[model samples]
Target: MMEMILKTKQVSEELGVNPSTIQRWVKFFNLPCQRNEHGHYLFNEKHIEELRKIKDQLSEGLAMTDVQIDIPKKEAVKTKEFTLNNEIEKRLDKLIMRIDNMERRLETKADEVVSAQLLQHRLEIDDLVKKINSLENTLLEMQEKQTFQMQDYHSDFMLEKPKPVKRSWFASLLQLFSMIKS
Candidate 1:
């Protein structure tokens, strides 16, 4: 008579539980399991029967401590180590997901910062343009004032001096006769 050995998946299927759950059960409840040459767990029919009993007890709302199954000390230690390793792996996966989420958020924040800076730069450029326009208008007004002042000065300079009073002919004759008598 050959004993039938089943893999974890097969046992989980037969028991209607997940494979990981089966491993946890094997660890916690100290269900008898044989390790294959490849270091995988193999369960025999007797092991299955023991698992069924444990499952029944659990389904009946019995606490693990109250189940009253004697497990070997060495096997319990091994199971504890396995459970701890599984826990660590699960925690590491969660931490990796958190880090990924944080990186995405940081990228989003950086984009927003760049956008804000661009808007600020645009506003500064607009202000400078307005100031330049104002300065140009002032310069044009000053030039116009200077041109009007120059035209006024030119008109003043061009005014002709009053013509010298014309000499009378009588006055000229009297001056000549006086000179001849002398």
Candidate 2:
């Protein structure tokens, strides 16, 4: 006897919810759902049970991310209907691939964030260097102006004085003799 696989509509009606909600749960929560050859979700009794539990958790005011789920390995039904080892290997491979993809995405995001921070710091340093150069040029100009003013002040005060007259004593004696004769 084969196990009955239910469609999305049937599961939705059974759970009294919309089909889109079931699809969302399967996609976002990685609910163990298999796709048919026509690319439609094929949910077994166990998958439906899991969906019911998810609905109950949501109804109890639990956040979607906080709702943890554990998917158990598929076991042989009755007379070894399927090879247990092969199924385990396939599931393990799929899980490893998913883990690798997540690792790559995390590394890429971290690198992008670091690069953005470095670029911001580089731009800020460039602006500061420009401001420093501008201030240096202003100081040099002020110093040059001060040097020129000092040179002009010194030239005015360092000039030579004129010599005194040399005939002062002879002129004084002649004026005294003339006064006596008068």
Candidate 3:
């Protein structure tokens, strides 16, 4: 069995990363590691080999998503004012223009709905007018027949009931006197 002996600094130097980064990764990913009686970390040879391969791949310019890290630093911003601002402004303008166009389309759709409703209402009104005209024609024919019947019937048959006969004031006085004498 080959003796496995390596320090944090040795691995850090080999990987071209600070020892703290390796320590953080060890803590975060829970890699297989042992602590000596002095409480110093000891990684096996296989773990060291795996870390070396990962470091090699990263140095060869792999995408950040593929690599495992505690926290990644932001990509360095290129020192330029005009291009960066212009790019942001262009994207913002495009977003605003797209929103405006969508709003206009929505407004047009709403107007079309209102127009359709108005057209429907007009159609209903036209139908109601047609019904009214048909009813008027019916009423005229019925009225003509009603007039003919009225003329055919004797007016006396439809006369109001005659009022009851009323006694004269003198007869009413004489009847009152007779009742008093009795």
TM-score against native, each model: 0.42, 0.39, 0.38
What tens-digit string does per-residue lDDT give for candidate 3 at 1-182?
A: 78767778777887789887677546433556777788666776766876776577668896323555332234222234534554565688899999999999999999999999999999999999999999999999999999988876747556757789899999999999999999
Task: Indicate the TM-score of model 3.
Answer: 0.38
Any runs in candidate 3 off by more than 4 Å, and if so which? 1-84, 155-182
Q: Show model 1 residue runs off by greater than 4 Å.
A: 1-79, 160-182
**Angstrom error at residue 52, model 3:** 56
Error of 2 at 156 (Å): 2.7
Clashes of 3: 0
Which of candidates 1 and 3 reaches a greater TM-score? Answer: 1
Ranking by TM-score: 1, 2, 3
Per-residue lDDT for 35-131 in model 1, tens only? 9999779999877877777778888998554554444665444456655665775688899999999999999999999999999999999999999
Q: Which ten residues in a row have the lowest lDDT in candidate 3?
A: 70-79
What is the alpha-carbon lDDT of model 2 when measured against the actual structure? 0.80
Q: Global lDDT of each model?
A: 0.81, 0.80, 0.71
Q: How does candidate 1 score on lDDT?
A: 0.81
